[model samples]
Target chain A: MKNIWTIAKREYDNYFASPLAYVIAAGLLFLLGGIFLIILQGSIQQAIFGGGTPVDIGFINQWFYYLLLWTVPALTMRLISDENRTGTLELLLTAPVRDFELVIGKWLGSFLYILSVIGVSFIFAIVANYLAEPGIDQVKMMSSYLGLILIAGALLALGTGISALFNNQIAAFFVTLALFIVLWLLIGIPASFFPSNPAIGDVFRYLQIGNHYESTFNAGVLYLSDVIYFLSLIAIGLFTGVTAVDSRRWR
Target chain B: MIRVTDLTKDYGPRRALHSLSFEARQGEIIGFLGPNGAGKTTTMRILTGYMPPTSGEAIVAGYNVMEESIEVRKRVGYLPETVPLYNEMVVQDFLKFMAELRHIPNPEESVADALNMVGMTERAKGYIGNLSKGMRQRIGLAQALIHRPEVLILDEPSIGLDPGQVVELRKIIREIGRERTVLLSTHILSEAQQICDRVIIINKGKIVVEDTPENLQARLVGGERVVLRVRGDAAELSAKIEQVKGVQRLKSNPDGSLEFEYLPGHDVRPEVAKIITNGGYEMLEMKTLSLSLEDIFLELTKEQVVTPKKKRRL
Candidate 1:
């Protein structure tokens, strides 16, 4: 555990020492802030005209979760790949740290950084409380934030795992981005397309992470099964990372 | 502190280490002398627990490298051929990070001590990327020593350094080897002779010879050579020199010089000098040549190459 923390602290400091973390955070905040302004204007206009329900800025939480599919890979792509490129992987391998500890530490470092970026987006929620009627739904907002954190954890783990398999940061980035995009697009496949084999379509839907996020966590409902689903994904991703790193010795 | 038995490593069909074996006791400096692609780095990596051998047993600091890797790692300090350092990190912070990884009790003091040991205390705050190659190599050495392990494995530790740095680095290594076992590899034979208490010369993944530097020199050099240059026709001088009692072989050079080889204890220079002066040719130079470490290395490896070829012909 101490070894894991030592690695995690160094990795976290590394993220901030470079411009990658700041660039991604600033870019996401700028784009999300624009969306928040549009939602705020729509809510004000609706309140004056009394045409429809008030727009809660909390609705933008889905965008935050979805954007992570793209940004998480960018955050985690250099975790192990850069180490391999710089030959530091050998140093780390020869250190008195376990493979699992290294992988978990790297993922945890990115998770903390992404969490902070998500935390900064809370300004949008505070703005909604003052600018919109039927402002932010506190319970629902909390659940949405929880969902975003869980999704970020899962994506970062998967990205770290993919990063371990590659020596080039660009290769790790594109592969992880492609995998995450495919997982996200799985939600669009309709069960009706598989009339004879509905179970296959059902399995696909069950595998799509958004299905659980949208149905349970996004609606302010807490379910152990949904939490377990994300945790299982995290476990699988970390296991893959550990295996890839350990294979270096054999090679 | 280090022991290996029948270590073998194969990358696909190419064998890297072919059942090679050696040992190093505590407080001794062992130099692994080999040419390129001779598996020196492979052996060091295996000893440091960075990788496992295909078929072998290695016990480092009383722990099996394959089974108790973490234990081995805790007791070993390894400096690879290419120093692995984080470019963006400050030297002190990088050392501190390594100290933390080693789980040192006081990272601050350890980092300072390491920096001082490598004479990089003033550059501790400088970023590693901005440092010169020599400075970076020193930093690499400092990080390896931060943990103060029982054994140190350095691979070509003086590859790119200037002459001054090489001397200083060798001095530091010799000091470190006083209480800890140090195993270093180099292609430079003189380096092995200067620093190694015992040198193991390997070629083609096999041990060619292993002995003290002086012993290897005394064993391989069976005869003495002398070069005599005179202001006269070399063909005439060669014929006279060959007639000397102890002269085994003589060859004339293009530069009006004759080289004479004789038994180890024989002094043929006086006889050759008499012959040269009797011909009324002014003797310009006469000097005996001593065999260098280079000749010993070539003789040993050359013999190995010949034996393999002869076996293949059969």
Candidate 2:
């Protein structure tokens, strides 16, 4: 446990020391802020003319969650791959730290950093409350934020796992981004392709990350099953990462 | 504090270590003398718990490397051939991280001690990436010593250092070896001769010979060989040198220099020079040739190549 914290601290400090983390945080916030303004403008248009329902500002997270496909990969691509390239993997593996500790520590460091970047989007919620009619729904906003954090955890864990398989940062980044894209598009598979088997479509929908958030957390409905789904993904990703690191000893 | 028995490692189809076995007691500096691809790094990795052997066992500081890896890792300080380091970290922070990884109770004190030991106290605040190669190597050593492990495994520790830095590093290693078991690998013959109490010569993943540097030279070359260049006729000089005690098998080289082999523990240079001068011949040059690691490789390879061919022909 102490080993995990020590490794995590080093990895966390490393993130802040490099320009990559700052670029990621700044770029992500800027893009999200632009999208937030557009949504706010559209909501005001509806309030003035169409007489639509009051805009739930927290729903902006629905759009922001997709950005993780880029942010998570950028943050995690160097976690283990950079260690391998620098030969620091040998130092860490030869130390008294366990393989799982190293994996979890790296994932936690990136997870915390990305969470802070996501935290800045709270400004959107505040802006929404000030301009909207009845103010933002606090329960829905918190649930949506929780959903985003969980999914980010799942994606970051998977990205960290993939990072362990390659020594090249570019390769790690592309492979992880490609895998996340596939997961994002899984829900888009046409029903005509799998005619006669609706179960396949259901399975794809269940696996699609967006479905869980759009249905449960975004709608202010917190389901135990959805929480389990993200947690299971986290477990699988972390397990594969630990195994990849341990396999180095045999090779 | 380190013992290996039949330790073998096969990287896919190629065997890196062929049942290699050796041991190091406390307060001993053992040098692993081998050329590149001679399984020196492979052996050190296994001993440090970075890699597991394909077969056999290794015990480091009273812990089984494979079975109790954490315990072994806690007691072993390894510096790999390339001196792996975090270039972005400050020297003091890096050492403190290493100390924390080793679970030291007092990291600040340990880091300070390690910095002082390697004479890197002044560079503690400097970034590792900004440091020169020699200073980076010193930081590498400092991190290894942060935990004050009972055993130290260094692979080609002085491979890229300047001459002055190499000398300083060797002095630090010698001081450390006074209290702990140190196993360092090097291809340089003189490094082993100067720093190691015992040298193990490995070739193609197998142990060729293991002994003190002096004993190996005496046993392999049979004695020291000396060459003398004179300004006069070689015939008279050779005859007089053969008469000196312990000089055996004197031969005249094509360059007109007299060569002779003398038994170990004998100093025949002064006597031979005296004879050359007394015979009205000015000695132009005289030097003793020590047995180099290359010579040992040649001697071993000759046997390996010949026996295999003879068997194939039969």
Task: Supply DockQ values for each candidate.
Answer: 0.78, 0.80
Runs in model 2 deviating more than 4 A are A42-54, A130-133, B228-260, B264-314
Docking class of 1: medium
What class would a CAPRI assessor give candidate 2's docking?
high
lDDT (tens digit, per residue) of candidate 2 on A36-107: 888777788664554556567655788778888777888899999989989999999899989999999999
Interface Cα RMSD of candidate 2: 0.7
Clashes of 1: 0
Interface root mean square deviation per prediction: 0.8, 0.7
- Please count the clashing residue pairs in each candidate, in the order shown: 0, 0
The digit string of per-residue lDDT tens for model 2 on B254-308 reads 7687778888788878887778777899978888776565566567645444443
- Superposed by TM-score, candidate 2 places the C-alpha of residue A47 at a distance from the truth, in angstroms, of 9.9
Instruction: List the global CA lDDT of all models.
Output: 0.86, 0.86
lDDT of 1 by residue, A1-251 (tens): 98888888898899889998899999899989988878877787655654455455556877887788889888888999999889998888888988999999999888888888888998888877666555667788788889888988999999999999999999999999998877888454765588899787887787788887976788888898778878888998899899999897778
